[model samples]
Target: MASDAPADSVPALPDPVSRARLVDAVRFDRDGLVACIAQQHDTGEVLMMAWMNRTALEETLATGRVTYWSRSRAALWRKGETSGQVQRLIDLRLDCDGDTLLALVDQTGVACHTGRRSCFYRAMRGDALVALTEPEADPAELYGR
Candidate 1:
């Protein structure tokens, strides 16, 4: 049955709160991507930073796993998919402007493909860059490459 009132006369319905609303809140850059920093949930150690397109973000949120947009591969890359170092999302937060995201996760195994716990293993010494930490596992062993 059709309503007697015209469409314009009806009061506006409240938008249902949904996960899509959270995704919509993010402000993607020109390339439809945002920077997402992955951090260790309990240790407070930064694991890595990567880009996430809408699809990656949505999938991560829906699955409670960490995913990123691989600019190099031009595809959505699920962390630890091949290396057995998956990051299970504990929480996801956005910066004040909603331009960046922080993914706190429970990381299994090494987070870096280089077999390091983190990508940030380098530091600047007095005169040159240096490796602050050694790889926990061999790269070849981690990726089986």
Candidate 2:
């Protein structure tokens, strides 16, 4: 049986042809959710991981922006709506098994709630991981400003 993946972990992107095949079909398993990885289009840096239901997936493809089902809010959220840190979709990829997705995006600003450029701002040091930087912008400022 497949194990539960670590939070925010992403399996590497597959090759173009193989990825294309999976994306075209886009079949999800019984859970009604698909694992999605947000990746920086130019540098290939992974930004975050989120879940996408069918509606979120379709909206993302149609709108050319990265969208995800916000489990916390229980609603569909287009990235950067509040923070103006939009991620424009460049391409979409799917895993070999077609159960997961990768969104290649042109990210404008922070992709993490903590205001890091990527969600993976922590680095593994000898026995522990440490945060590398402070948030560039304030999260409260994003609410209305």
Q: Choose the strongest candidate by TM-score.
A: 1
TM-score list, all predictions: 0.87, 0.77
> Ten residues in a row with the worst lDDT in model 2?
1-10
- lDDT per residue, candidate 1, 35-108, as tens digits? 99999989999989999999998877766767799999999898877777888777788899999999888888
Candidate number achieving the greatest lDDT relative to the actual structure: 1
Score candidate 2 by lDDT: 0.73
Query: For candidate 1, what is the TM-score?
Result: 0.87
Instruction: For residues 1-145, write the lDDT of model 2, one tens digit per residue.
Output: 0111121222232344543454457777676778899999889898999988878877666556677889889899878877778777777877788888888877776888877788888888898888877888777775563
In model 2, what lDDT does residue 19 have?
A: 37
Off-target runs (Cα >4 Å) in candidate 2 are 1-24
Off-target runs (Cα >4 Å) in candidate 1 are: 1-17
